[model samples]
Target: MFAKTLSASHQHGKRLSEPRIRQLGSLVTWLCLSFCSERLEICDFWNPFRNFVNLEHLELFADWGRPRKLVPFSAPEYGLTQLRTLKLRGYLPMEFVQWLLNEPAHVEELQLCVLDFPGIHCGGHGEPEQFFEAIPPHMRDQVVMDAIEDRRRLRGLARFADYQDKAIAPRSLACLSFDTIRRFKKLNKLYLYKPAAGRDHDDLEVYFSVSSEFRILLEWRDLILATRNTLEYIIFDQRPVCDLRESDDQAEIVCEVSHGDSYKRFVDIVLPTLIQGETFPALRMIRLFGFEPYEDDPCKEGPQEFELLGESENVPALLQAAFPEAKITNHIGRPIFIHKKWGELYGGGDVLNDTAGLLTIGEMIMY
Candidate 1:
């Protein structure tokens, strides 16, 4: 039955007059057009589809597989009333992002690849700020801005600091990822890459000063207070600072101190506070990476067994004891232990290794 409809549509296109063609174009489910050169006069072909009231998906390609100037295609007439997804491949203008945000009621998912601006140099001319301001307030939370290897273009994003202080500032955003931390009000999830260590203090100070709505993930924890209480997941990626010199290395060896002491301070002081009942009432998961075990000190230990310092095998057990009803799964290359309640709730696992063990327990809870 579906095949016949397609066949009829193809036949109709062949026999239809130009006026009829315009009518049929308005009902197209999908449209793909290519221009040989940026100057190609192809406005008529686009006009019909621009009025399409039911376009669910759209893809527009230009330059005929070569680098050429492209023109902006207006979508207001396309009746994006029912459009669910929109994808643009090359040279998307700033106006495109604005258009998607304006039609918040119809678009559920939007992917924009600003292929022309590989370095994302739009910030130099104030385009980045202008682009962000054009985003509809209601849709800011759902937008994801992705750039590739373009740090210099984003350096000036701190300019938004002034706008953030306004009374009618935008606050519906639930997720945001940018090259810098300037102004964020209701962010819940964030992903940042390769941040400069020198800028760490300022970045953290900005976030910590604001109230966290839910979760935050970043490379450093310098500003996280033991009392913030709202964070659920914390991940740290420790890479040595670029400015360290031979003299700095020599001092560290003389003092017999590891350079990672600052990170340890955060874990020791902040981590324990989260597991306590008074903080993070909904805390469920805790993950620590690149962790080194505590070295034996004359004052600290007996026969070397897996202890809490470097080998955190016992950390999960301590947390389970504190939150008796919580599910605790220690991720240390294997499934260490599961409390009886969690075991029954998630499905019992062998003390050693059980692949499907946790799933069974989760299913029981749902039923």
Candidate 2:
């Protein structure tokens, strides 16, 4: 189940109570709450989970993929011993951690990514340690990588060298993505996304800064060393920083990062780096999440939209030679942008039932 809240007032269990929760107890297996906050209290707090007897997966987040809070869990009330997978982000209550580890749950594997530095730039409590200290020893290795930044990005490469000394010793492949060859010995999947900018990134300035051309190359090199021995898939989420309008037919302009060296860099530098390394023995596929920009002329009489073209032809060869034993997928992102007949915009989903030929450009805004 997915639940999002504008504020912390949504009583997730209000609709489900005591005996009623038991109705779907056998059927309910997963529960996920991604929100900005979590306020724990008596009464209806655990009401929804009372009869979640078979719940095997539970993911609780704070501040929208931030971290989960460490609120005490007084009782399971009816003995919820079936939990198997627990993923916690943000702050977590120490008392509950012990309960999850001690009782029938004995959750062995944990998934978590935390950022608790005053300089983290994220809106919540920036001090990361406060959240981690609340976690018990049984859950330490479960901590995934959380990127380290010194105000600006790229130029901040020097910081990764000292990461081993930091508490919680972040070692997840995804968290330390920005700094390559940082030492996630068992890392398999790596992602390098040009964060889509807009309201969702209001604090972007404080998080990262522009990197020099050489610095970008260095970033690629870091990726090479890090993935040399372990990577299996490389997913690149390419989105331009320029605030461009959502695609709305001919009038709406497509803000494609593929228009620049981003794609070329991946082809010319990043890909080549994969083969040059001694590792990457497990490397298989490289996926690029972007598409080339094209023009539309509906008034001139033609197809409704652009062709469903994927990555350029030559990329497959480059990836294949690097990992002659693994399969390669040049999965390209679709250029279809959501534009409502009314003047509204959206990110995902096929472009339909709306103005499909207009295009515009402005700051990238997302709800």
lDDT of 2: 0.37
| lDDT by residue (tens digit), candidate 2, 174-244 | 22233224533454544443322111113111122111222333354565565466665555444332222
Give the number of the best model, judged by TM-score. Answer: 2
lDDT per residue, candidate 1, 1-367, as tens digits? Answer: 2111222233323334555555775668776544333243322223334445567766553222223323334557333556655544333344443443343344433332222222223223322443435343543342222222112224544336532321110011112223212222221211111111111122122111011111111112212232133333333322111221233332122112122332333344344554554544444443332222223232224553323322233454665676565454432111111112101101111211222122222342342
Best by lDDT: 2
C-alpha TM-score for every candidate:
0.29, 0.38
287 Cα displacement, candidate 1 (Å): 17
lDDT of each: 0.31, 0.37
